[model samples]
Target: MKGLKKKRKWIILGAAAAAVVLISIIGASMNGAEVESAVVDKGQVIKLIKESGTVEAENTVVIAAKNSGEIRKVLVEEGDRVTAGSKLMESEVTSAQMDIKSLQSDLAGLQAQYNQAKNLADKNKTLYEQGALSYEDYNASNTAAKQLSAQISSLSYTIKSYEESSGAAGVTAPINGTVTEVFIKAGETVTAGASLFEISDLSNIYVKVDLIAEDADLVQVGDPVKVYNEDAGFTDENCKVRKIHVKAQEKMSDLGINQKRVTIEIALSQSTALRLGSNLDIEISVDQRENAVRVSDKAVFELENKDYVYVVSDGKAVLREVELGLEGEDFIEVLSGLEEGDVIILSPEDEIQEGTKVKV
Candidate 1:
């Protein structure tokens, strides 16, 4: 019985010892706060201005009707590749043709009368000089000749104008490009200067972006840019800013917010796979650092216009003031007060403060 009692005592003591060990472990773990952390590192960080842009042809040309005419045939459709001066359509310019003929006939009659009047004027001038003609007769002959000459000149201009209108019967492509839009078809009566076709040189394409004034201020001509279309799986990193507008204009955003925007143009390469008028994305590298001590932006916070980060040291959260340099998308450049291997608490909570226990 004494032996069994001693065994029971030993078992109870063993259980008590195990319970005390577990309690000590629980207390130790609860002493420090649970937090996410990251280590500071040195790497390249690029400050990029991301914006949606539209693909445009650098050499886009709009073909318009030279004169009023009825479309008799449309030989080219949208997406047709055409060369300069290629016949695109034909029109029936019957009215213009008839008008040209009438003007020409009138011009011929006026020329005949002008010739006769000029000859008479020349003879009258000689006769007046010889005292055979009066001043009134000479002046009348000269006036008649002037009137006929003016009429002939006016009729010639009319004939030239009608002939130009008649020449509009054949509409042609003015440049070498792919037809992007066709506004008129057969049997359509179009007025002079009406838009007929829109052609774009696909090989010479560019990206156009209207950046907000704040973003535009950081951009300049010759800045490196990356053009991409995520949905289409197209990307071209060899693009550069080609132009910047001199003025900013007020524009409405997609969400109806008013913003002042400046236009920027990016030049793409000849091998670019962008389609005209398609929306693509562009990232401009405005600033960069080849080797910068960087930390995740989440670890950084602002206090009274000063930047700070919660650095972990000696198992405690240490609030350290840091001088920031360049701001990047995912990380920020740490200028001072942070080392390459220092550990920091990511997204430190409001309840966390200096000297607070932190468990990584």
Candidate 2:
């Protein structure tokens, strides 16, 4: 009975070993299959070019004093709205008025002298014709009359000049606008031709953008543009290109790189939120594409400075390098190395390897 028990134990042990071998073979076969993964579908993408510039009134003027004098009163302050011919400031014209009055008095005196000289010359001429006066006396009297007339004409011109100067003491606005700067105070003295105020016609404002010469050709007059400013609270306002400068300006720092830039003036159709001299960030659409293949920026990887995407084929992870075209905010355009039905891995981890088994 002990020998029969020993034989049964041996049989049980052999059967257990065979079952273990079969299970090992099955596990190895399952591991050899390719891993399955999720992929992104390719579609159309749109590209945008960005630039920064400042907002300015299309019609702006700098108010300067035509004649130098002390500022006695300022009619307007910064941020004041004014109309055309509005008084900006008044200079102390007390001396100017005195000079004008003196000139006028001189002109009157010259006119009186001229009238007396003319009467005397006429009387002398009549007497000389009648042989009552000597020829030398009449000639002298005629010459004196002509000289006095010339003097009177000269005085008239002087008086007109003084009048113009006196008028300039009251500075006036050339256009209807808002006063952006007030450089002179009520009691300050300013020199002639010095800027005292800056006025901007906010009704017509524009954005000035500098573009590199290489890329300037892509833009043209009448092109649509969008402008925005974070601080001034401006966003995506419709605007059109008003002007484009053709001259190329040299780059400040680089010598070998000879580049010309264009200044594009874009007129804002809606400027309710825009302010004069407000810095703005602009985006211009040079070209647009519809229904293009695109992928999330996170899925795209860089290797050796080259772009790549991980694709799933036959349930196996395959890394494929691709060429990129236009880049957007959340997605990048795929120019090559992808298809419409191809599946790709999203947010791949470092530990994931090729041919590794994946549930998704």
Which run of 10 residues does model 1 get worst, by summed lDDT?
160-169
Name the candidate that leads on lDDT: 1
- Residue 215 alpha-carbon offset, candidate 1, angstroms: 0.8
List residue ranges in candidate 1 displaced over 4 A.
Answer: 1-31, 66-69, 101-169
TM-score of 1: 0.74
Pairs that collide, model 1 = none
At residue 227, what lDDT does model 2 achieve? 81
Instruction: Enumerate residue pairs that collide in model 2.
Output: 39-344, 43-292, 43-293, 43-294, 44-291, 44-292
**Best model per TM-score:** 1
Question: Each model's C-alpha lDDT?
Answer: 0.89, 0.77
Q: 1-360 in candidate 1: lDDT tens per residue? A: 999999999999999999999998777556888899999999988999999999888798887787787899999999999998898988885676766767777788888888999999999999999999999999999999999988888877767665556563366777899999999989999988999999898878888999999999999899999988879989889899999999999999999999999999998854766667999899999999978999999999999999999999999999999999999988999999999999999999887899988889
Q: List the candidates' TM-scores in order.
A: 0.74, 0.63
